[model samples]
Target: MLMRKTAALLLLSLPLALARPMSTLAQAPVQYNVAFPNAVHHEARVTATFRELPAGPLQVRMARSSPGRYALHEFAKNVYDVAATDSRGRALTITRPDPSGWAVTGHDGTVTFTYTLFGDRTDGTYAGIDARHAHLNIPATLAYAEGLEQRPAQVQFAGLPAAWTVATQLQPDAAGTTYSAPNLQYLMDSPTSLGEQQVRTWQEGGRTIELKVLHEGTPAELDAYAAQTQKIVREAAAVFGGMPAFDFGRYTFVANYLPQTSSDGMEHRNSTSLTSRRPLRGPGAIDNLGTVAHEFFHAWNVERLRPQDLEPFNFSQANISSNLWFAEGFTQYYGELVLRRAGIYPTDTEYCQEALTGLVNAMMLSPGAARFSPVQMSQQAPFVDAAAAIDPNNRTNTYLSYYYIGAANALALDLELRARFKTDLDTYMRALWQQFGSQQQNYAPARPYTTPDLQRVLGEVARDTAFAGQFFRQHIYGHQQPDYPALLAPAGLLVRPARPNKASLATRLSFNAADSTATLGTTTSGSPLYVAGLDREDVVLRFDGQRLVGSKAFEELLSTHRPGDVVQLEVRTRTGLQTVPVTLTEEPALEVVTYEAAGRPISKAQKKFRAAWLSSKVR
Candidate 1:
C-alpha cells in the first residue's frame, strides 16, 4: 500500500509558475537540444536556437562562472566543434572573438550554434556524462546569447539510454520531455540528473517534497531514506515557523549517491543537488543526512534571505558575499542542531559534546581564527571557496574557513542571547524569514541585505542596538575571539585541560607506504617544523638520524618527547636535501566534556539552561 502510494505520488505532476520577462520587444525564446549519443566519450552535443537576431555580429558565450559558487570556472574550455548555421541551411561565418565566446555574422536574422562539450566531473559546479547517464550543471554545458539572456528558455534531451530518466527543478511539459525556465539564471540553477532513479515524495504544510535519488541501494533502503529525509524536512520547517515559499509549490532533492560522482551538496532556489561517492546505508548514511539538513535550511538563509552582494548573482565574474559567515556558517551550525532536535543525535549531552568537541575546539585551535575575523574570511571566499587553482599558498596560517568561524560565532551568539536577553538565534533567524524570506519575491539583484541591515535585524531581535554593535565589531568584523569557556559554562559543558601533555612538530604529514616517504601537507606557521624550515610537500627523509617510515613513526617519536624538546630532521626539499634542527611544542590541550561537569554538581539553574538549549522539543 505504501509502495503504491509512493508510486502514485511520483507520477503526479504539479503546475509550475514561470515568471515572464517584462520586455516589450517581441523575440523568440532560447531553445536548447542536448544529446548524449556517445556517452562513453563523456561528451554532450548541444545546439542552441535563436530567432530574429539583429543583422550584426552576434556573440554566443559560455558562462565563466556558476551560481552559488564564488569563483570563475571558465566553462568554455571544454566547449569545442563550434559552428553556426542559418535558417536556409547555409553555414555562417564564425570567429573566435575571445577564449569563452564565438562571434558570428552574415545570418538572416535566425541562427543556431552547435557545439560539443566534454565533461566528466559530477558535482554542484561541473557537468558529467557517461554510458550510464549524463548529469548536467547547465551553466557549464549551455551557451547563451549576449543580449538574449533575459528571454525564456526551453531544453529538450535526446539520445539518452531508454531506461534513463530526467529529474530537475525545471517545469516539465505534459510530455515530460521538455523543461522550461523563465530565464538563464533559473535555467543554470536547475541541475538535471539523467539516469535510472528512485523517487520519493512527502507533503507538509501544503507543499510537496520530492527526493529523486540515483543510487545502488535496494528499494527498501531507498524508501527508508526517503522517510528519514521527510522527517528532516519537517524538523527544519519547525525552526523557521514554516517552510520558505518554494518556487514551484515543491522542493526537489536531486541526489546521485553513486561511486561515479564526487561528494557535494549545493542549494538552489527550488531544489538541491546531493552527490556522493557512497550510498545511503549503514551508519555512514547519517553523515550524509547532515548535508541534507544544511542545504534544505539554505532555502531560507541564502536562497531567499540572501546578502545584497549575492542578490543578483553575476555569471561572468565572482559572486563574493560578505555575509557567508551567516549564510553558510550559521546554516552549518544549525545543521547539526536540527539533527539533534530531530532526535537524530539521541541526547542533549551527546549533542553538546559533539558541538564543543567539533565546532568549539576547531575555532579555539585554529590560529587563523585569531588572525582573521569571520567577516574578513567571508570576504576572502572568492579565493578559497572552490576558486580556480593557483600556486601553493599558506592557507592554514593565514586563512580560516568561514564555515567554522560562522558556526562558532553562531554558538556564541546563541548562548549570549539566551544568557543576556532570554532569547536565541532562532528568534533572529525567524525575524529575517518573515521580513526577507517568506514573501517569495522574484530574484532581485539590487535588494540584498547589507551589514547595516544585519545589525538592524540583530538589534531588533535582541532589543539592544549597542549589544548587536559590540557583537559585530568584536566577532563578525573584528578578530576578537569568543570566550567559549565562559560562555558555554552554564550549558553543562565542562572545559578542562586535556591529558597526555603530548608534544609534536604540529605539521600535517602524509606518508606513502609504497615509497616510505612522509610529505608535509601543512605545517603550522610558527611551529617547530615551520621555524626549522620544513615546508608543505617537503619529503622527510630521516628523523633524528633515523629513516622516517610513516606518520605513525613520526608521532611515536614525538610521544617520547615533551614541549621545548629539540629534534633533528632531514628533508628532501625542492631546493635539495637539507638537515634542520627543530624544537617541539605541546599539542593543543583544550578539551570539552559533556555532563557531570568534571566532578562538579550541576546547579538547578545550569540544568535548566542546558535543558532549554538542547531539548529536542521546541517551545
Candidate 2:
C-alpha cells in the first residue's frame, strides 16, 4: 500500500504530458506469416497491413534475432526480396527500413515483405524437430521488425499442410487460430508458434487457462502438464498483488530436443521455448514446468514493467546496459517460488537448501569463475550480444546466455531483501506497481534503476530500510558472489556435506536386484567400468567365463587405476554380448573449491558399498 502511494506521489511529480504515451496503444494493426512448408529453407512473410498511413519511413524491426536474448538483431540479412505491395497486389515503391525491413510511402494496405530464414533447422537449430515443428521467438526467425512495429492486422499463414497447427496467445478460432487484442502493443506482447501442438487446459478460480506445448513428445507424458502450469502461473501472479496480465492471455511453451541440444531455457513475452528431446512427465519431465513458470512470470516484470534500455528498443544499435538481473533473474527466482507455493517444495528450508546446494556446486565446479560474473557481465553474454544488430550476425560461438545466472541472483537477492524486511517479498512488487505499473507501460521507464530508485521503493515498504541499497552495491553490481550461507541461514537451510550426484557401474553391478544383470543407460568417459573397456552396456562377466556378481565388485576393480589408463574387460556378444577393449580418456574436472568438501571418509563397514556406487562424472 505504501509503495502504491509512493508511486502515486512520484507520478504526481512527473509532467502530465509524458504519462500520456504510456497508456496509449495507439498504433495501426499488422499481420504476419511464418510459413515453412519445409523445415529446410524456411521463410517468414511479415505483412504490416496498416489500417492508416503515417509519415516517416514506415520501418519495421526485430529485437535481436531471438527471444530470451536481448540484442538488436538486424533480421534483414535473413530477409530477401524486400518489396512492398498495395491492395491490388501491385508493387508499391518501397525502400529499406535501415536494411531490415521495407519502408513504404503512401496508402496503408497489405504491404508484405518475404524474408528467407535458414533457421538451422536440423543440425543447426537443434531445439526442435524441423522447421515444420518449430516455435516462433524474437520475431526474427518468423517475422521481423519490432522498433517501428505495428499491431499485426491479420497475421495469416499459407503454404502449410493441414496437419500443422498454429498456437498463439490470441483469441481462439474454430476455422483457424485467431487472436484479437485491444491494440498493436498487445499483439506485439503475444507470440505464436505453428507446428504440431499438444494443448492442456484447466479451470482455476472460475477461469480457464491453457498450456500449448509445441514439440515431438508423447501427449500422455504431458497429462499432468496443465496442472503443473496452473500452479506456477497462479502462484506467481499471487505474488505481485494478484495477476496483472490479462487473465485470458495465452503463454506458449516451446520444446525442441533434438538428439543433442543444450539443457537450458529462453524466455519470451507471452511464451517460452525449452530444450527437451525427452518426455514432459515423471520426475525429469517437470523441467518443462520450471521454464514455463520462468517465462510466465515475465509477463508482469519484463513484458509490462521493464528496463529503460529495453524499452523503445533500437534496432540499428545495441543496448549496452545491465538490468536483465532484475527482469530475467527475478522471474527465475519466482519460477521456483511457484514450485514452493504449489506445495511441490515441502518447506522454505528445503527450497533454500536445494538452491544453495546447486549454487555451491556450480561455484566449486566452475573453472571460469574468475573470468565471468554471470550476474554483472551477462549483458555482454552471447544471448544479449548484438549479433542481430551487428554485421557478421553469426552466433555460432559466443554461447553465454545470462538469464539463468542473473535469475539465480534475483532469487537470492529477493529472498535476502524479504528477510531484511521480515515480510513477504511480494510487497516489493506491489511497490513497483504502485510506482510505475500503469503509467510506465512502455519498456523504457525502467532503464537504469539508480540508488534513489531503490531507496524510494524500499523506503516505502520498510521504513529506513537501506539494506537493499547496500546489498545491491556489495553483491550485485560487481563480480562478487552473493553471501549464500549468510543470506539463506535466516531461511533455515542447513548445508549438509553435499552428496555427489554421480552413478557407477560397480554400484550397478552390486545392487540387490540380482546378479548377472546390467543397467541400460548412456556411456561416459569418467566411469570406472567404462575405463575397464565398458562400452555403454557391455555386460560384465567373470574371467575364464566366470560371472561378476555386482556393481560392488565392479568398483573394487576400478579404484586401481588413474584416469587415462586402459583396462581390459571380458563381456558378452550379439549371440549374447562380448568384451570390447577400449582405452580410458581423461575428462575435464572442475576443481572442488566451491562444492562443499566431502564429509569425513565413509565408514569401513560402508566403504565396500560406497566406493562402487557413485561415479564422479555423469551429467
Candidate 3:
C-alpha cells in the first residue's frame, strides 16, 4: 500500500514538470538595441524589449540610483519620447504612475519600450554622446521592467562609425557589437565607451588587464599612461595577495581624457570608468594617475570585500552603508599610498606634503570630526556624494567626509598594528579579502561583512580581541581621534603646526573690490570668528580701531597680533552693526614632515621602519 502511494505521487509530479518544461519556465533575456541617430545633438535612441511577462500590468521604469553612488539621481528627466508596443506590433496603452516609471497594459505577454535619451555630460554617473564618442553609464541610459531584474540582458550598439569600437566589462557575444550580462544588477553597473580608442593589453597574474583610452593625445602619451597604470594595478593587487578572479577572466580601464569629459572615476566589479578633461602631460598626468590608483583599489575593497548594507544595491532609492569609512576611506588611503609605493611619489617629503599632511589636517581641523564618528559620517554620503541641492548646507561645520576621516583612521590603525601587533594594515586587508571577497558566489560577494564582522576580522588579524574592540569603540562607533604625533614617531615623521607664528581667526573672508571691507564665509565653530558671533555674510568694517580696507590690511593686522591677543572688531551683522571683541589664536593647521626636515637626527631603527612602511610590496 505504501509503494502504491509513492508511485502515484511520482506519476502526478512528472506530468506537471513535462507540461511546464524547464525551458518554458525560464525567463527570456531582456534585449536592448541602442542607436545614435542624432549623435551630434547628444541623443541616443534606445529600445528595450521584455518578453515572457507574467499575467499582469508590465511596470517599466528608469533607475533613480546607480551603483557606486550613494545619492538618488532622477535619470528619467533625460528620457523622453517614450512609446511601447506588444509582440504583434500593436501599440499598447501606457499610463504614467510616477515620475520614473510607466505601467503598460494590453501586452501579449511581451512589450517593446523605446525612448530618446538626451545626455551631454560625460562622467561616471551620467551618459554623454556626441559626434566624437558615446559614453554610456548604464543606469543613466537603460530602462527595465520592474519584475524582470533577475532575467539576463543583451545589448547591441547600432550604426557606429567605421573607426569606432566598444569597450566595456559586458561579456561580448559572437557578434562584436553586442554584449551580455547575467542580470539587471550587472547590466546597470556596466559602463560602455564607444568611439575611436587606443587599446593596450597585458597579462598579470595569469589574468588579462586592458586599457582603452579615448583621448586626443599621442600614442606615446597613452603608452606612458598605460605603463604607469600597470604599476598601480600591481601594487594594489599585492596588498590583496593577488587580484580578484574577474568574472570573465579580464578587467578593463575605460578612460576618456578628452577636453569635454568631466573629471570623475567610478568602479565596478571588473572595470572602472575614468573620465577627465586633463591631458596626460604635466601636472595633470599625475592627478589623473591618482584617480586611477584610487578607483582600481575599489575592485578589492568595495566591489568585492563587500559591505553587507550595500549588497544587493537598490535602484529606486539611496543605498546607505555604515562601512564607507572602510570601503571608500581605506581605499582612499591606499590610493595615495600605492602611488608612493610605486615610486610615483619618489620623496618622503613630497608624499607627506602632498598626501599624508592633507589627510591628517583635514581630519584634525574639521569640527565635523569632533562631532561625528566614522560610521556617522559614512551615513551622510547620500547628501554629499555628488548630490545636488539649491539650498546651502552647514556641512563645513557639521560634516567631515568619510574619505578623509577613514583614511586618517587607516593611517593611525596601520601604525598601531605595526607598533603593537607586529603586523600592518596590508595583513588586515588581506585577511578581509580572503574571508569576505575571495569566494565569489556569482556577480556579488558570497560573504558580505557587517560592522561587527569588521571588528571580528581585525581581532583575528591582530590576535587580540580587546584591542580590536577598543579601537572600534573609540574610533569607529565613538567619536575619538587617534594620537597622530605619537603614532608617527616610530617612522620619524612629525606632525606639527603649518604656520607657527601666524595668528588667525580661522575663517575665510572675501574682500569687496569696491571697498576694504571683507565679508566672511562660513565660520568654523569654536574659532575666534565664531566666538565673536561672526558668521557667513557678516562684513568686518573695522579691526582694532583701524578701518579694514582689504584682505591685505586684515592680514597685516593679524600678523601684528599673537595668540591670546584680543582686539576690537566692528562688524555688520544681519540684525545691525555691532562692536565685538575678537581674540586671536594660533592657526590650527597641521603638517606632516620628516624628522630630518625638522632638524632632528633620526635613528637607524626609525629609518628602517619608514622604509618598510613606504616601500613597495610588489614581490
Please give the CA lDDT of all the candidate structures.
0.80, 0.49, 0.88
Summarize candidate 1's per-residue lDDT along 1-619 as a digit string, tens digits. 0011100001111223445444412457777767665567788778887877878988999998887788788999999988999989799999998898899899998888898889999988999877765678889988889887667766565545556677888877778766777677788898888788788888877898889888888999998888778777887887798876676688899899878899888999889989887779987788788889899998888888888888677887778888999999999998888888777778766776665567877788788988989888998888887886758887888888888899999999999999999889888988877777666544432245787788889999999999999999999989888888888888877766565478877667777787677888778777788888777889888777777677778778778888888878888988999988888887765677765847777788888898787665543
Ranked by lDDT, the better of candidates 1 and 3 is: 3
Q: Model 3, 454: alpha-carbon shift in Å?
A: 0.8
Residue 218 displacement in candidate 2 (angstroms): 5.0
Per-model TM-score versus the true fold: 0.92, 0.63, 0.94
lDDT by residue for model 2 (462-536), tens:
665466566565545544566555554443333343323222232233233466645433333335554454443
Return whichever of 2 and 3 wins on TM-score.
3
Q: Which candidate number would show the highest TM-score if scored against the true structure?
A: 3
Which regions of candidate 1 fall more than 4 Å away from where they truly are?
1-26, 157-159, 349-355, 443-446, 497-499, 512-517, 537-541, 570-581, 597-600, 617-619
lDDT sort, best first: 3, 1, 2
Worst 10 residues of 3 by lDDT: 6-15
Model 3 over residues 1-619: C-alpha lDDT tens digits? 0011100000000101112335533767787767777777888888888888888899999999999999999899999999999999999999999999999999999999989999999999999988888788999998989877766666565556667778899876666546677778988999989888799999998889999999888999889989999999999999999988998899999989999999999999999999999999888999999999999999999999989999999999998999999999999999999999999998999999999999889888999998999999999999998999998789989999999999999999999998889999999999999999998775889899999999999999999999999999999998798999999999999999999978988887887767678898889999999988888889888788887777787788789899889989889999999999998889889999999999999999999989988999999
lDDT of the structure predicted as candidate 3 = 0.88
Rank the models by TM-score, top first. Answer: 3, 1, 2
